[model samples]
Target: MEYMVNLEQFYGPMDLLLYLIEKNEMNIYDISIALITDQYMDYIRATEHIDLDQLGEFLVMASYLLNLKSKMLLPDPVEPSEADQESPDPREELVNKLVDYKRFKLAAELLGERLSDDYPRIFYRHGSTVLPEPESELSATPRSLHRVYVRLLQDMLAQDKYQIPQGDINVGEKMSEIEHKLKLAGRPVHFLELCHRDLGRREILALFLALLELIRLGKVTALQEKRFGEIRMVIKC
Candidate 1:
């Protein structure tokens, strides 16, 4: 089974940072490092499951924010020079990067809009086709050509009638299935059994929520004997 995970659903750390900054109505040039870092950590902690590859960048950015905050807490070193010597802000580099990235993002959006508006109008002309001579009694008509095109389209669509698209996995339904499985086994069941490898991301998420709901309801006990071990589910008496 092929898995179709939409990575676009997740936003990068920079996007989150910008959101926080704008949400707080704070100036990008002089952001409150401590406040932003705390808010960032809250968002990170709120996420229950994350792909490590995507999470790594967020963690790195979080560390950078913390470091900036630490610097802000400390007093600046005294400068002996009186000749217009100035210390740069810790967030200067980060702010510059955010500004540049925002510019690029806006430019890409504009380009996409322009392409969408203009691309369909730019069509290639096909070479002339040899037509079959019609009998004197029969004449070719545009209506006939349109009817044939519509029939062809309808036939193409009908060919896939047997293949049904998968519907959204429901958490409540999955929870009931898990409960039935545990009752049938009369013993502990491995987590992987409940969450099949072939299941798509949406199904996996649904299964996870189902398990959590069961746990919350005190209907099942989830256990792992060792660190990084497979979770075992046992029906609660």
Candidate 2:
């Protein structure tokens, strides 16, 4: 009977090593390096046409296995101390690497299965031959929104140059102030209205950060009605 081996299944030397270990029903921690090396060499010789780049990696692994096998066969040198007699196994490092590789391979297989299951539910919108006009809300890009803020900051800075001689402005205090102002107004307030003439650059920045924090917390929301329009802050109901 002729035996056919599928060489394409093995990804790398570690993968091939894992397969050989499992096939022989051998413990991964106490692998028989001599037997594995001989089987690996058989596989390499059996293959007619192999990629040079891939073959190099397998050859390096084979050389390592041969060297390790030789080390295992050699008798230990005479040592005076008991601590020197309790030396670590030569296969410990290789066993650790193989264990890690096996864990990652298992995780990858799980992810691939999940992706395959969800593939059917994934929908893709087909493109139309005729292009349609974009919606008004979609027309306002982040760049335009940034420009509006920049313009507002420039106007505020041009009006006042006096720096406040105070300690670090508290973002929590600004957030409380914003909450109070929004409650009093009972409507969406303009972003610029949040800053006062007496406030310094740092104070403004702190207030802006506070607003962002509030929005992130889902307590407040910022909205732009039109393209390059005023951004309004509203307390969420």
Candidate 3:
């Protein structure tokens, strides 16, 4: 069997960084900036006829890594100021960003796998229970309902009992639910966790559009601490 590769499967610069770190089993915080930078540049160079527009963000990240490499080579300044003493390590922020991105990326991949596995399993399983319709005022209503239900059941069994498709989602109502979640959170929450993986595609799309609308209206703010990072949504105070 021949295997095909799709470069677009990779999300962003951080994805490449995580690959490098894991490929060599290097600690995230203790990355050898020079080594990783060279490997990253080499990968970019190896891609044939790469679109610079898509590659721009990665190139920018490469420059950042190179700058950090240069900083690592320089001697610590003598007689550092009090503010400098209180400042974080130069690589601390970058490490934190990478760690966060890796976490969400892994989570997304797991969700994808679960979805794939779930789809196949759904076809084989048979539902044993039927929901009982409520009692009605007219005796004829029960008979009519039973006939309709039997007809539907026969059609489903004849058609191999596929899952019923979901109904149209109300975007406006979903937006309100998201707003309520934000209000309850009272802080930024990871966007992925808001909609949930089990939600249908239509529902997810509605939630996403709702988020964008909220952002446009300035009722909420969407932020990424770093490029190619997980988006976080905050309720505007």
Candidate topping TM-score: 2
Q: Estimate every model's Cα lDDT from 0 to 1.
A: 0.84, 0.86, 0.80
Residues 59-177 of candidate 3: C-alpha lDDT, one tens digit per residue = 88888988888887887664666555655567887899998998898899887886674555443345533457877665668889999999999998888757676787987887788
- Tens-place lDDT per residue, model 1, 1-237, is 133333335468887888889899999888998999998887777765778888788899989999989998998775667436777877899999889877887898887886675555444466233356877696769999999999999998898796558797899999999999999999999988877777877898898899999999999999998999999999987
Candidate with more favorable, higher lDDT: 2 or 3: 2
True lDDT of residue 11, candidate 1: 67
Report each candidate's C-alpha RMSD, comma-separated, in the order given: 20.5, 15.8, 18.9
> On TM-score, who's better, 1 or 3?
1
Model 2, range 1-237, lDDT digits (tens) per residue?
A: 155554556899999999999999999999999999999887777766778888888888989999989988888664757556677889998899999999999999977886675554445477353367777575778999999999999989976776444897899999999999998999989989987897888899999899999999999999988988887999988
Which pairs, if any, clash in model 1? none
How do all the candidates rank in terms of TM-score, highest first? 2, 1, 3
Write down the RMSD of candidate 1 (Cα, Å). Answer: 20.5
lDDT of 2: 0.86
Model 1 gets an lDDT of: 0.84
| Model 2 misplaced stretches (Cα beyond 4 Å) | 1-6, 78-84, 118-237
The estimated TM-scores of all candidates read: 0.46, 0.48, 0.45
